[model samples]
Target chain A: EPEVTQTPSHQVTQMGQEVILRCVPISNHLYFYWYRQILGQKVEFLVSFYNNEISEKSEIFDDQFSVERPDGSNFTLKIRSTKLEDSAMYFCASTKGVSGGSSYEQYFGPGTRLTVT
Target chain B: AQSVTQPDIHITVSEGASLELRCNYSYGATPYLFWYVQSPGQGLQLLLKYFSGDTLVQGIKGFEAEFKRSQSSFNLRKPSVHWSDAAEYFCAVEDRGSTLGRLYFGRGTQLTVWP
Candidate 1:
């Protein structure tokens, strides 16, 4: 079963530094998403990307966050500046187009653990 | 303005005992509901989802969930739980009409299956 894959399983960075979390979604998937889960908190949606553009974003995805599909398979989330609160498990997910009335289930990657200090 | 509520923060059950996790949502129309599981330090895994007909949906790992539109709930259930079933379960919802496919997730219920 083709699954989403992310790089840098664990990352430690300074509080003010910039960081990029990379994901390679399933080859045929058209929609991609980024979600985060702070320790002991519910997974929160960050942003959704389609056609190489952002479709929607949450409040938490403020000025500091940006997503890019630099290549066909790579979907990357970039944080301009990190804060302690940015430390969390960042997950990447993707799914086929929403049609056919079939629920296009998003498949998640193993996640990249971001640790800011 | 959509949200999901998972009332139980943590639940414990003995091995081979039946299990059920409650989930409720606040949505105007028929919402797309989903259940996901996460083991400690792991990413989320889709357990099941409900889109339209046949309120009862079967999923992986011997799990099932029923969508009750009258109650605005989609609760996950299992005939018998194993020790390996211990994990954090999350309930999420997305408005069918929304184009972004952005999902709203609940706080989650941590299941502890005792041997």
Candidate 2:
């Protein structure tokens, strides 16, 4: 099966440094999303992207977070500044949108483990 | 707002035993429901999804789920579970009314299989 792929499986960064998590969603997917899970916590939605614009974002997706589809296959999430609480597993997901019949299942990536010290 | 609830925080079953994980959701109308599993240190793996048609939906890894609109529930069941099946299961829902594809996930239930 064609799956979403994320780069830098694990990352360690300083508290105030900026970090970019990269993801290459399925080639044909039109909708992309980013989610975060603090250790032992629920998977929280960060933002959803479509047509190069953000469709929706959660309260947690504040000023520090931004997502960009710089290229056809790359969807990247950048955190302007990191905090200790920012450490978590960041996941990238994509789906074929409603146009692809009824199969709107969002395929998830292995995830980028972001560790802020 | 759409939300998912996974009642059992943890479940333990012996190898070869039947397994069922409970999931409940609160939504205005029937929404897109899905079950995802995550092994330790791994990303989420979709197990099954329910989106109309046959109330019972079958998915990967020999797992199936039945959608019950009356109870507002989608429960995942496996006839037999192996040690490799141990993982954290998350129940997610998408509110088609708003937020086209944003998924709201439950806290998740950790499944532990004993040999």
Judged by TM-score, which candidate is best?
Answer: 1
Give the whole-model CA lDDT for all candidates, comma-separated. Answer: 0.91, 0.90
Top candidate by DockQ: 1
TM-score for each predicted model, relative to the true structure = 0.94, 0.93
- For candidate 1, give fnat to 2 decimals: 0.66
TM-score of chain A of each: 0.96, 0.96
For residues A9-110, write the lDDT of model 1, one tens digit per residue.
999999999999999999999999999989888789999888988888889999999999998889999999999999999999999968325757888898
Each candidate's interface RMSD (Å, one decimal) is 2.1, 2.5
Screening candidate 1 with a backbone cut-off below 3 angstroms (N, C-alpha, C), the clashing residue pairs are none
What is model 2's C-alpha RMSD?
1.7
DockQ of model 1, rounded to 2 decimals: 0.63
After superposition, the stretches of candidate 2 with alpha carbons farther than 4 Å from their true spots are A99-101
